[model samples]
Target: MPQHRNISCHLYIGDTKAMEYNVHNVDNRSTAHIVSEEGQTFSFKIEAGTALMSAARLDLELWADGYKLDCFTFTESVYEVDDAQVRDQVTGAIKIVKLRFAKLNTVDQGPSNADDAEAEQLKRLGTLEIKLWRSESNVSQSTTFPYADCPLQTPIHEKKIKGQSVSHVTSLESKGTVAQQSSWGYITTKIDPYDRPWVAFVFKHASKALLQSEGIVPKDEVKEKGAAVASAKGKKAQSSRAKVNDTKNEESKVEDVKFDDDVAAMSQPQLRQEIMRLRKRPGDSLDQSVVKARRTMKCVRTPDADNLLSTAEKGDKRK
Candidate 1:
């Protein structure tokens, strides 16, 4: 038997209730249309057979309220069988599937000239539901859909940490004072400890004096110099420590060699005695010593050269 295949996908924005509210606020709802990347229109009707066989492979786009909902990809197969025998056998099989995403409550309602700077505002509030099922005949399949409510609160807000003091600058004088204080604190905390407070005090006084004078602002050059000085001191300390470690390592190596020489000198007599005792043993030790000594020893020059010459001459005459 040849199996029939069908696929269909639909993108839904707002529900009936949300749509009612959106229509009243005409600017919030997006018109129903498939928009391609290049601003092209895509319109196609899904056949029953195609929707049944390949609905699971379709991708859905959902937009509602002010924000665009996340896109959902279907995974359930829907099938419509025309063969009487096959239909009778699989009478209760699901044939249609649909997916709906959460609705966005906010839509841009400001004038076109506002551009991207305008904050998105919510036009209506509602939950979004997605439904998936199969239809046996031409009748629409009834399935319960699951939905999630769209949160109405703004996503971004100015937040202050607990236990922090809030400071506001409303006038030029207040803004200048706040900026000077902030720069002074930044310099004190970020620079070297030795120079931090001194530089901060100098800048703070200079800032105050400038505020009293023609309302001028002091620069942050002192903070920069303090940081540079601290960094140089740290490098110097690190290098000095490294030099000390190198000296210690050299001394340790010298001590190790001296210890080894002392040990060898102390053990020399004992080593020789041990070798002699091994030579007296009844095995190959004595033979090995004779070979070793012969290889190692050299002839010594005698001070009695005349006696050595006379003995050699006599031996020659006798021979």
Candidate 2:
């Protein structure tokens, strides 16, 4: 997470903020070093900056692996964004899609053209950045924007790609489970964007091993000896507690929980609301219709994080 102008932002991987390694600040920008994994979903959350939220109009841009995903705006009324917004082109409609981390593969052209201008683009890879800009007016965003059309970098020569380790890049997730935003909105106005952002949050993310190889995060740095010992003791205590309680067992089965009628009444894509309604209940029957609905739902359903999110209360009531 990085903070500037009383505004703080953190990269989220499945609802939890990615663990930041080395964090430092310089002027209007803050950089955090983090780790990410392939196939895992990711997003960003912007905390409301009271003063900035009250007085200024804002715009946000999300960039990952040199590809700018989406641009959103905020006004006095709307000051923050919940999840990262990505457009889904698969559907002919202007629908939003989810993004997940994936291995960034390079088209190797071997070591001869190391000085090529395209190699410069590699510098932006393995980094996730969010820019906060001061806008003159609320903007009506044109469906298509310049950044979205930016071309991906050309293949780097083989020699340059051989030794360099590029970690992961954002890839579209077909089966989306994140629901941070019910819908996205923009303030419609025609205006040029600011030359520079008011503040910037840069997150340099890669695999932990790669980060350590580059010396960005130290390797074998077990300086917290006491904490390590304490952690082990805590784990032992937790294990003892788990023996008498089904809390841990029940919590881990969050993905196994079936849907309810209310959850099946929603609109749009992802899990078909109709299939959700077919879930067995006191009055429900597991007949042909429900069976067919269940088959249709196999493509969209995912582990529902919300079911076990209430930390204070948990466990099945069955005695």
- Steric overlap count per candidate: 18, 11
Writing each residue's lDDT as its tens digit, candidate 1 over 132-194 gives: 233222222224322223223332222211222111110100111111211111011111122
For candidate 1, report its TM-score.
Answer: 0.19
Model 2 lDDT per residue over 33-100, tens place: 88889888887778646635444566778777766777876665334343343444343223344667
lDDT (CA) per prediction? 0.29, 0.61
Whole-model alpha-carbon lDDT for candidate 1: 0.29
Worst 10 residues of 2 by lDDT: 310-319
TM-score to true structure, per model: 0.19, 0.54
Off by over 4 Å in 2: 51-54, 76-95, 107-117, 137-147, 150-165, 174-193, 218-319
Predicted candidate 1, C-alpha RMSD: 30.9
